[model samples]
Target chain A: MDILQALANGFEVALQPVNLLLVFVGCLVGTLIGVLPGIGPISGVALLVPLTFALKLTPESAIILLAGIYYGAMYGGSTTSILLNIPGETSSVVTTLDGNQMARQGRAGAALAISAWGSFIAGTLSVLALMLLGPLLAQWAIRFGPAEYFALMVFGFSTLSALAGKNMAKALLATLFGLLLSTVGQDPQSGMSRFTFGLLQLEDGMDFLVVAIGLFAVSEVLMILQDKAPPAVQATVGRVYLSLKEFTFSLLTILRSSILGFVIGVLPGAGASIASFVAYTVEKRLLGSRARFGQGDIRGVAAPESANNAAAGGAMIPLLTLGLPGSGTTAIMLGALVSLGVTPGPQMFQQHPNVVWGLIASMYVGNAMLLLLNLPLVGLFVRLLAVPSWFLIPAVLAVSFIGVYAVNNNPFDLLLMTVFGLVGYVMRRLDFPLAPVLLGLVLGYLMEVNLRRAMAISNGDVGFLFSSPIAIVLWVLAGLSLFAPTLLSRFVKRGALGDDEI
Target chain B: MSNPTHRTDRIVGVLLLLLSIAYGWTASRFEVGMLSDPVGPKPFPYLIAICTAVASLWLILRPDPDPQWPPVSFWLPLGLVLGSLVAYAYLLVPLGFIVVTTLEMALLAVLFGARWWQGLAAGLAFSLVVYFLFTAGLNVPLPAGKIWGLGR
Candidate 1:
């Protein structure tokens, strides 16, 4: 089917009242999660995956909900950066430079409005591009064999390991650790137990949900303790509507950043963080001295906000097309899809067109809903930041505990979660990138399976990894991905890229 | 709160190295009945172990100069929170979800400076609402407790 036809079918699925409600709820909850200081989109979605189960959603509806959260977060993540000078997620780190300044100048309303506008425009535009590009990529990716897949997995791993942390060694270690952990259950091929350590509880291996929530949610709570306290919210929402001049001023910026962000986000290693960071820097360099680039420049606010949102859309392309998640949120989404028995790849378009297209169609609807919610209700979300940390902590922790237990009803998993919480805390403190660990854990099985299949086909010849043209290209890309961080850091100061890889 | 020159990375490296060794040893001991694939499980595990070993060695040799360490004062409360979670994990089934969770949440909130009764009130309210939400709304049955039977 053509893109338009599939999207029409998708609209049929997405327009269901229950699905609409889920989309609305996901976007609202996602914005709230993003605006809240302690959790980002990854943790927000990871913490709520079980809730979707509780709702007993179909795979399509569940993905619609989760995808809403993923992109809705990009819109909300900027609010903190603009208002409080603290980024709710790494993607918004660059927003603090100009956004906070705009707020201080009592242009907070304008900045927030512009971001909502920029996000809505760029996000929807990127979705349109996704509609066009997704099929083309899927068509090309359909030819991948086991060797090609093995090489692609290597490429994915290298891209993440190289750019997911300041130190490639630490990131690589995190990946290896995750892979080792993944090997704990029975071997998929041989039924050999690799690392159960005599525990029947672990025979099925670690539930990615438990590890994810433990790493992102529980560890985030612990990290909050290190904060003396958040800076008081002093910015007032004067007016949310932007002036015509401001809109005219930022039009080109939004367009440029959106296009730039989408391209970077399509690259496996480059995530929304880089997209925003690079966007802001490029905007500044291009408009030097003509516009006040950093200090209260409305274009500054528009550039990164639009870029990050567009980047988020771009990041989903790889995950949907090649089953290679470029960012942490997409990785978690991939994990959720697999757990739901929906494998995302080129075949997904053909096999599960409703799920794919429904998710795509919902992105358009969700983006519109976010613009509706964030514009006038920006005051409400900003008010949420006033909630005392203590009150929020208990609520968050309670939700985390109940969410985990409700899914499995197993206390052993809770204990296992706490262990991962400690591990995640240490990783965060030491600045080890946590995304790779999750990605590695999620993809480890697929990687090993693909490798073994390829080897089996080639009769244990390691050279088979480089046999096919696609595989060879992927391996070469993987080789380059290993050095991406060092090379990229040379152009952009390492400081410009925040420590949070996701 | 910040360490300009920290040996913690080296400690982490050594730990990772030990883990690599242990993992390799364990992989070598795996007794497979039959190999479905030529590469089997051993090769993949070995490759991962070697990567871990190599990564750990590199980390030890070139540790970042400035790695932030946790604050000294935060350690006690951090430990307390983790301990409470572990306790909650073990106690949830025996004490039931409502009773155990209420206590756990209250204690956690109070440790961070919520008034004692305020914490209790919030905890009780939170737990009860969540219990109904899960059991009634979601149809996922949570444990009421083996000892007191507080919830169904």
Candidate 2:
């Protein structure tokens, strides 16, 4: 089917009353969660997944809701970062640099407005890119053999571990732990139990939702408890509308950052946080020493906001096309899709056209909804910051508990969630990146399955893994990604030496 | 007092090393067919075990110089919250969703420094709303306590 016709059908599905309502609810909930400190897109989506299952919505509708929350949280994240200087997640950290500055300067209104507009424009643009790129990538990926798939999965893991956090060893250990956890069930090929430890619940392996809620939601609650109180927000939001001159001034920065963010987003493990940072830095470099970047510059707000939203959209492309989630948020979305019985990969377009297209259409709608909601409702959202953490924290935990219990009505899952939550807390305290672990768990089974399948097809010859050009390319890419940080640091050090000699 | 935080990395590394050994040993015990496919499930586990072992060793040898452990005040609240969650997990099915959830939420709120009465009220309101939302709206069959019949 042509893209236009597919989109038209998607609109038909997305515009249905129920799906449209879901989109609105998703955006509202996403914005609320995003506006709240410590509850990021990952936790927002994780908390909502079981709710979607309970709603019994069709796969497309369920995904639309969850995806709506994903990007909606991106939009909402800037609100807190701007107002209170506390980023809702790492993705919004750059926003805090200038967002809070703008708030302090009494231009909070302008910053918030520009952020919403920039995000909407960039989000819509990236969706356009996704609409164009997603199908092509999926079509191209259909030719991949198991070996290629395995290599690509490895590339995803390598890039994730490399960029997940500062400590490569910790990131690697987290990934290994996730892989170990993924191994704890009956082996799919042989029907032999590997690590069930003689428990009935363990036979099915850990539910992704359970681990996600534990790691993101529960851990977040625990972490929030450690804080004495939430940060105070400025009461008077100056003005909601941006001046025409200011909008025009930021136009180019938004455009540049959107594209940069989209490219960064498409790269595995490089998410909105990196995209926003790169965009902000690039814009700063473009302005050279004349930049007033950290001092409430409107362009600072616009660039990161635009870039992060664009990156969010860009992150979806790989997930939709290759079934490889680049970040923790996308990993949760991948888990949601898998639980819905929708396998996202090269064949996703052919097998689940409505779901693929409906999600795309909903992104457009959800972006528009966010823009509409955030602009006029900016005051309302800012007020949400006043909701006491004492009340909010437990409320979120209650929701997570009920959400997890609702999944299978299994108490054991809750116990598992608690265990993982504790583990997540410790990992966070230790500065281990949590995202890579989710990525590992999400990809572990697939990686193992593809590896064994590739070996099976190759009749036990390991050389077959390198026989395919695509596989070889992917392996090389993985290796390069793993070494890229070290290589770049070395190059920079050498450049410094050359400068010193001069 | 050479950076008290540095000790954490060493401790974590030693613990991880021990974990990897146990993991690898257990992985080795997984039943594998002698002639069954070349790359069985055991290979993946063993691979992870080795990676973990190596990474832990690296962490032990080159511990980060400036790890910032949470302050002493953080533990009491952290422990309280964690303990409540574990208790919630165990009591959820037995005491029922509403009863245990309300109590757990209240405890958590208090742990976060809420007043006792305020925490109890907020927890009660929140848990009741959630209970109704899930049980009635979403068709999730939350447990009612055999002791009180508060939920269905």
Candidate 3:
């Protein structure tokens, strides 16, 4: 079926009373999680997966809810950054640069209003782009061989490791560790247990939900405990609506940043954080010395907010079309999809049109819901900041613990989650990027399956990896991604020092 | 400024190197199936082992300067939180979900510096609400207490 027909079907699924209620609930929960520190979209979605299973909703509805949370969190994330200067997630880090400044200047309402408007516009634009691009990419990807898929997976890993954090070595180590963890279950090819350590639970391998909760939720709780409590939020939020002049001034920046953010989001491993940073920098460059860019500039707030939301939408493109998750949150979403018995790939649109389109339709509904929720409810969310971390952190932990336990009705998973939580804590302390580890875990099985399949087909000839044109192109892209960071940094350094000095 | 750079890096590197060696050694013992393909399960683990070894060596050889550690005040609370989680895991199935969760939440709240009554109230309220929400509303089978039949 064509896009319009599929989307009409999707809206039918999305607008069903149950699905609509779920979308609303997802948005509400997502905003709450986003407004609250320590729990992000990853953990929020992870924590809810088992609950969705318990609810026994159809896969399409479940995904609609989860996807709602994913983008809704992006919208809610800016609230804390603007009001309290604490970014609820990595993507909101750039928002705090000018968002907090605006709060301090007592323009918190204006900043919040612009962020919501920018997010809505960018989110809508990106969803439209996804509607256009998703099918085309899926059409192209249907022709990929196992070798090409393997190369693409490699490229995903390399890009993630390269941009995951400041330390490439740490990121690489995390990726390797994740790959190792993925190898814990029975091998799909041989049915040989590689590292089950003789537990029956080990037979199924580590649940991604457990790992995600431990790594993201539990680790965050520990980190929060280690720090002092957050300071009082700035409460002088003047005028919840932006003036006509201010809105007009920021329209171009919002549009430009949205496009930039969408492109970055489509790239594997380059997520909202990077998009926001790049958008803010591009906006700064465009403005020059006309305004103090970082010092409470409304354009700075508008640009990053628009870009990050746009990027969230953009990140969905690869996931929906290629089944390759471009970011950590998308990785969790992939796990959710797999658990729901839906394998996302080029054939996903053909096989699961309702699910793919319903999710797309829900994004439209979700973005609208968020735009409404955020503007008027900004004050209510800011009030949540006063809810003590002591109480909030423990509540998150309790939810995580229960969520994991409910997955298999086993306490062992809770213990495993705790262990991973500790490991996540250590990794965080040592500055390892958590996202790469997650990416590795999510992609590891697929990578191995494709590699073994490719090898088997080629009669164990490793040369086949380099033989196909698509495979060769992907391999070259992977190589470039792996070294891109080093090359870019060197070039940046040289540029900073000027040609003669270099 | 007084401290040497990369103290944590050197320690982590050494630990990772040892882990990779152990992991590599363990991975070599997996039995290859009779009908297994030429590239078996061993290649993936071996690759990971090699990556870990190389990365750890790199970390050891060239550690990042000016690594920041959490302050002294952080350790006690961190330890408390960790210990409470472990305890919660052990106590969960036996003492039941609601009871253990309540205790664990209260303990964590106090550890994070909440007043006793405040922690107790928040923990009790939070645990009870979540328990009912999951068990009654969502149909998740959280364990009823063996000691007292509170959750069934």
Candidate 4:
């Protein structure tokens, strides 16, 4: 079916009572989590995945809820960055540079209002792009073969490794660690056992949900424990209603950032963090001497917020088309999909058109839902921010434990969950990237299955991995991605970190 | 904080290097006699071990490192939290849900630095809410004890 017809069908599914309610609940939960310091959409989705799993959701309904959280959290994250001077994650860091400054200058309401509107604009635009671009990419990706798919996975892994780490060696090590973790279960082909340490639990390997929640959520809790910043008190809280003039003035900045975000988002390794940075720098360069730029500029808040939201849409490109996730959030989405027995790749668009198109269609409706929910209810959400951290901690822990238990009606999973959580906490304390671990857990089985299949096909030929042109190209790119970090850091430092600043 | 952070990183890096070597040694013990394929399951583990060792070495060799160790106060609380979790895992089956979870939550709250009564009350309330939500509302099963008829 054409994109229009697919979208129409998606709307039919999305508008149902259950799905719409789920979308709304997902958005609210997402925003709340996004507003929380240190927690991002990645952990937000991971922590919630068990709930959805236990809730017995249809795959379509599940995707709608998860995707809604993915995008809606971006919008909520902008709020905290603007008002509290604390960005929830790296993506919102740029928003804080101007946003918090604006708050200090008494334009908090205006900045908040414009950010919400800018998000709405970029979000709506990206949905239209998703409707058009996703189908096109799906059609083109239909030509891929096993060798091509293997190369694509390699490319995906390389891109993420390079993007994730501070240097090439670190990225390589991270990627290698991921590949190694995949070897911890019974060999898919040879039936040879690996790394199981004689434990029966290791036979099934690690559950991605366990790894994801433990690494992201548990690690996050540990990180939060290290914070010296006091729990945020409401600061000059007010309604977030934009003036017509204010909206019009920031419209151009929003447009520029949206396009910039979309482009950056489409790249394999570049995520919202990069998109926001690029958008902010470009806005500064374009504004030149006319604007304050970082000193409480309205355009400053608008640009990054719009770019980040648009980038969320852009991040989906590689995932839907190539079965590769570009950011941590998308990685969790990938995990969620895998849990539902869906393997994402070029063929996924053809095989699961409803999931792809329905998710795309829902983004449009979800954005509208967030914009409506965020405006008048801004004060209400900010008030929620006032709930004691002590209370929130226990509540969240309880819910997470309950969700895991309900999944299998087993306390063993809950124990496993806690163990992983402790492991996650330790990893975070050491500054290790949690993303690699999640990537490892999810992709380990697939990599093994494919490697075994390829080996069997080639009949013990070592050169089969490099025999294909696609494989050769991918290997070369992977090699380059190992070095890309050092080169990119130099250019990024000049524009992003400033020459003199840390 | 900075000195401790760097010191800890160096210690952790060295430990990881040692761990990777052990992993490599263990991996080498997996026998694949005359396997037709050039690579096998063992190859992946050895490769990972090598990479881990190399990365750990690199981290150790760096002169200046992030000079921020998490506070001992923070870490101590986390340790208690983890200890209680382990305790809960072992005790839950024997003692039942309410008794074990109530103890777990209470202990965790105190470890998180809550005062005694406050921690006890909070833990009890949290456990009760979970019990009701899971068992009553969701109709999911929970362990019932002989005494409470619900927590075991």
TM-score list, all predictions: 0.96, 0.96, 0.96, 0.90
Candidate 2, superposed: residue stretches over 4 Å from native? A231-234, A494-502, B1-5, B33-36, B149-152
Candidate 3 off by > 4 Å: A232-234, A494-502, B1-3, B149-152
Candidate 4 lDDT, A1-502, residue by residue in tens: 5667877887888888998898899888888877876567887887777666767787778888998888888888887788888786678899998899988988889888898899999988877786678767877767665555666677777776666644434444555565666677677656767788887766766666666665666656656656633465886656566789988888999999999888778766677777887888889889999879879989998998999899999988888877777776787788778778777777877788778877887788899999999988777777777766665665566666655556555666666777777766765555666676666666666665566567767876657878877678887887776565556667676445431111
Clashing pairs in 4: B2-B67, B96-B152, B97-B151, B143-B152, B144-B152, B145-B152
After best superposition, candidate 4 residue A182: deviation in angstroms? 2.7
lDDT of 4: 0.74
After best superposition, candidate 2 residue A107: deviation in angstroms?
Answer: 1.2
After the best TM-score superposition of candidate 3, give how far the Cα of residue B83 lies from its true spot, in angstroms: 1.7
TM-score of chain A of each: 0.96, 0.96, 0.96, 0.92
**What are the per-residue Cα lDDT tens digits for candidate 1 across A90-114?**
8899999999999999999999999
Regions more than 4 Å wrong, model 4: A407-415, A487-502, B1-11, B31-40, B61-64, B111-114, B139-152
Q: What DockQ, on C-alphas, does every prediction get?
A: 0.73, 0.68, 0.73, 0.41
Task: State the displacement of the C-alpha of residue B88, model 1, in Å, after optimal TM-score superposition.
Answer: 0.5
Question: Tens digits of per-residue lDDT for model 4 on B52-110?
Answer: 88878776765235546666677676776666666766666666776777776666555
Once model 3 is optimally superposed onto the true structure by TM-score, how far is the C-alpha of residue B147 displaced, in angstroms? 3.4
